[model samples]
Target: MTDHHPDPAAPQPGAAAPQSACPADWDPLASQRRPEDPPLDVLLSGTVFFDIVFTGLDRLPEPGEELWSKGLGSSPGGIANLAVAAARLGLRTGLVAGFGDDAYADWMWHTMSEEEGIDLSASKRFPDFHSALTCSIAAQGDRAMVTHGHDSPEPMSRLVQHAPAARAAVVDLAGETDWWGRFTSGDTKVFADIGFDETGRWDPADLAPLAHCHAFTPNAVEAMNYTRTESPDRAVRAIAELVPLAVVTDGVDGSYAIDQTTGEEAFCPAVPVTAIDTTGAGDVFAAALVLGTLAEWPLEQRLKFGSLCSALAVQQFGGSLAAPGWGDIVDWWGSLSTAAQAGDLRAGYTRGPYMFLDDIVPDHPVQGRRRAQGTFAMRSDAGHH
Candidate 1:
């Protein structure tokens, strides 16, 4: 497992002068696309969970009563969803995670590293430990899940040790602050989100990461709790003071964001979709946020794109596998025409991102066997093998 240990040289926020803008040298690819020289656009660190999902069940199983699910499938879940979401959106994404060399881990790692095009150069493997597992059951409009696993051998903060200089990083709020400083020192945009606080403490210190994060996205409750504010707008304002851009997402009411750069705020209603399962919607929401910010689009446009993406994600069964890609977005837009708009927001939102559609080539490997089974071994704990 990747160690959560801090890198001795990891820069601390405010310890040095702000990272300078683009350096003197100039290569079109290096200067513009990869400002940080990171081989990938985003390098993420989180736990990898093997998910077993059961869908299409009309109701939850009664105590000891037999139940039949209409569908059953499996996929890589947990923070893996964020990595897959970014990759599907055309971002060169990498993930630093830990894995046990069990059957579930083998399949999950192969599916993510091979099928998804995510760079797992910083990931580590423990042949003896049992990989994490999540069993999810979907019934009616809701779902229940139970996860089993031990903590990763290392904390997620250690990813910076092995990852290249990425333009942005997706991380949790309570995670290591040192990585935030190190990443930002190279002009890497750190996008941070907070986890649920069952204790309801919602410490203001949790927002400490915002000091280094280029953007901070928290759900309505998380934002409100952290800010001690009642409304999403207030929460956004309080947070905007700390970060360049602050977003507070409210389920059906929509999402609110304040762009400190422009002093502009915007809100977009959630796309009303017959949700099948909302397992990975939040992660999908964060993915759109990352892209919209990177593309320098308007706050309203970013919110709309995120809303649509999350709305689409829940319409499928599995977690990360349910993430919608550009292909899915275009298809959903095409389907909207027949629905006659009906206030579902069919236009404007798709134009900016959709314009680049022609450039992406579908991931269809022509010849049989894209790589060898031993290919997973190519990645060494020594870093970026």
Candidate 2:
């Protein structure tokens, strides 16, 4: 068993230089095109199972090399991690993924069933396949992971068919070719989160089925790979041409989005926090983005919420342990604002309407203020009234 340990240098709330920004405009209904909520009921499909994560360790062994982990335990892996993050944030969630007949799978089932707002009727037991496992090695709060999938395509398809009513369906593109069409054709809003292989690569054609998906969450590296562009802005624009909503996250540099309607680019700054293990940080960000969309918090707020969730996610060792609840996120945001206000850093800082954190973090403090006001002006003119 590998032991997982959190990085000692990971930033605690008061430890690092606090990131401060003006609170985004609290517009509760800024992006509600429809009268009804998008879909609070979330169906999480794709890979699911216990992840045997190891932290405070090094690379996977070669032919023969001893490695020690500071901790070891099981938590939801892949798409399930997003589900857990959403559920913790008080969304009604369900799972449509395959599990194995192993003891680890049993634990996964039991834990997910007991989660406050998650429904697991769609989870299946695959006898031939063991539960998925991910072993992570943490160095300076960054992680390297090795994962194994024990299930085949056939069983995964069956599990997906059993999903209950869901407002949106989040699919981890773990090589699920057939599932995309089915979900998109259904009443569910589709969100695809693509995973990266050891080569740090994936094919853009893999996302073709999800062309009209409600949202696509890709990290900066994946965005570059998908669009074959060195510039994140160009990558986002390229992706938005394919999908209506393209969210590209760049670790500490921040994130950007391409608006499908007007072909505009929106950037948000990374919530400044000392990261510990950025293992499931992106997953957590994706989950929050989807949830915020469901709530119609406007594009800017949705991205900020995601940034806040991700910032909190990297403070711990494992993915699930680091995931923060809604209250914790609010506190973090509030703390950021408080810190910013207390320091002399507020020179020329204009607290415009609250936008996503990614928008403000990358620019000079004064520039961010100007950008925030400009965003509000554009939104006002763009029929967000």
Candidate 3:
């Protein structure tokens, strides 16, 4: 794909490298389509978890110690983070997930389908099953989490028959094999993510899904641990050999990605922001990455946009609600000085053999540039910060 974002001032030795063209009929802000909806921009499949988060912890608690938190909020989490993020960014997004008949499931379905405008026609509500639960304890820049729930045998788990058609899908590398075949119809793209192997398995066989994926994203730790590499750069390079694109996100430091197809690489510097809770920042990043790719953006723009999205999510509480929309992005953009908006914000990991990035904040020419409109509509009734 050709880079939608071009830097006129820079000297790109081989910027002449071929890139894919933008999608023929994609529009960022057209009216949202409903049932028998047009093909979706992105589709996601994973178990939906009800997230309960606690913040303001001085340190992790001892086994016998009681802990008190200064903040608390709950929302649908797990892959729901990506779903909401994609919807808020104005992608025609859909999800194939499973839930239970309990109140938690009802709330999740309502929040996703009604509030966030995500398509869940392919989702299932299990009468006998209970939705998954995640307890997040956030401190410093990272969070520790514990999850509990049994696997749902519902149809959503088996995605081959239930998943809706979309241009791309975000799925776990360990997910069912059939999903790999089901979603990649015509020109569909598959973006793969990974889950931790508690058993220390980290088996190569787990990477089977990569065979069908166009890109793979993993956190620094997950990337290093899975690839047995010492750093995120080496891991990304190693994984790129398996797929057309590879990215490894290092929290606070920034992120790195390589498009083997175009021989284009970028190491984006994270925008400086005070983080409140980082429970689902990775999911937010992945969602934004999916959006940038669907828009056929330059590799640098894609990474920078993902970093900004993840940074914004960390500033808010709750999982899905924390995912920022176009309004939030524009609001942040409006806060920057003209130079900051037009020049590169060099505040993150910098060592690499790739081109330096300028225009860390992208332009908003086609969409209305009203700074006041940056307040996202998906915010809660209280207008959560």
Number of the top lDDT candidate: 1
Ranking 2 against 3 by TM-score, winner: 3
TM-score, every prediction: 0.79, 0.72, 0.77
Candidate 2 Cα lDDT to native? 0.59
Error of 1 at 78 (Å): 0.4
Over 4 Å off, model 2: 1-40, 57-73, 126-129, 141-149, 152-154, 197-204, 262-264, 334-385
Candidate 2: tens digits of C-alpha lDDT, residues 84-199: 67765555567667667776676556545532235666666667678777765665545666777755545556656655556777776656656546667666778877767566
Q: List model 3 lDDT by residue over 257-364, tens digit each.
A: 999877899898786788887767888899888877876678987898788788878878887778776556655555443434355464112212112223222344
Over 1-385, each residue of candidate 1 has an lDDT whose tens digit, in order, gives: 1112111221222121112211101111222464436566777887888888888898988778988887876778888889877766666677788888887787667666655556676677876888899888888877778889998777656755866667788888765555556676667888889889988888897676577678888999999989999999999989899999889899878999999887779988888778877888999999888877777777887888889889978877677877876556656655554354444455544344444333322323111111112223322221121
In order of TM-score, best first, we have 1, 3, 2
Ranking by lDDT: 1, 3, 2
- Give the lDDT of residue 233 in candidate 3: 91
Q: Between which residue pairs do clashes occur in model 1?
A: 2-154, 3-154, 4-155, 38-165
Q: How many residue pairs clash in model 2?
A: 16
